[model samples]
Target: YPAAPQRFSCFGFDDVNAALAAMRFIHASTPPTELYLRVYQLESRQLPRRSELRPPVRSSPCDCGFVGNQDDEDENFLAIARAMEEIVDDRVDCYWLIRCFVNQFKHKFGDSIPHL
Candidate 1:
């Protein structure tokens, strides 16, 4: 949360490129190369480990007929999830669902998480 562009919002901000841009901007640095390194480490952990960033390194068969990397269960899950979470009407949105999920479990998480 270092030098984040402050915001006051009750409306949805997730799934918007604007929010991503703001984040990228906040962590931006010109000639200060150190920022990029920190940013990479932060972002790597932000989603998943570096290994998970790429597809499975190797796939081998075992006793279960087929055993391999199932899939990247990180953002990929939420990508499909958000699309499917859309309702037929305006009663609920992906944003609300994500907010609800974070609210429900954020407390259980450690202090690393700032807010929902």
Candidate 2:
């Protein structure tokens, strides 16, 4: 038999300091294994300075056409590139970060994490 799925919700903040404070509190209260982190940013008009030149616009409309803002699409691509860069950054120690998070959890909640 499969185990039951667990679910929980925590406060989300847009401000960096507030978000970090919330994370610290949550880490101290909950087991790191049970914590789920979700990061997102609101869409803004600002775009990266290194975007490529826009593609030539089609003169005549075709049966199949893309109906969307080209600039927005470019911005989305830039965002994806930035995320990939972070994922591959040599200085980012993912395992150490996870251990630190888990240690914080253990420091407050003890060795065993309560199952929900």
Best by TM-score: 1
Give Cα-based local distance difference scores for all models: 0.33, 0.32
Clashing residue pairs in candidate 1, if any? none
| lDDT of each residue in 13-113, candidate 1, tens digit only | 32232343455532333211222222323433553343444322222222112112224222322333334355422212443454455345444642433
Mark the regions of model 1 whose C-alpha exceeds 4 Å error after superposition: 1-16, 22-80, 88-93, 102-116
Candidate 2: how large is its RMSD? 19.9
lDDT at residue 62 of model 1 (Cα atoms): 21
Please provide, for model 2 over 15-100, each residue's C-alpha lDDT reduced to its tens digit, 9 standing for 90 to 100: 42255346442334532211212122211322222244233222322222223355433333333333344464421233234334
- Compute the lDDT for candidate 2: 0.32
| Residue 84 displacement in candidate 2 (angstroms) | 0.8
lDDT of 2 at 7: 14
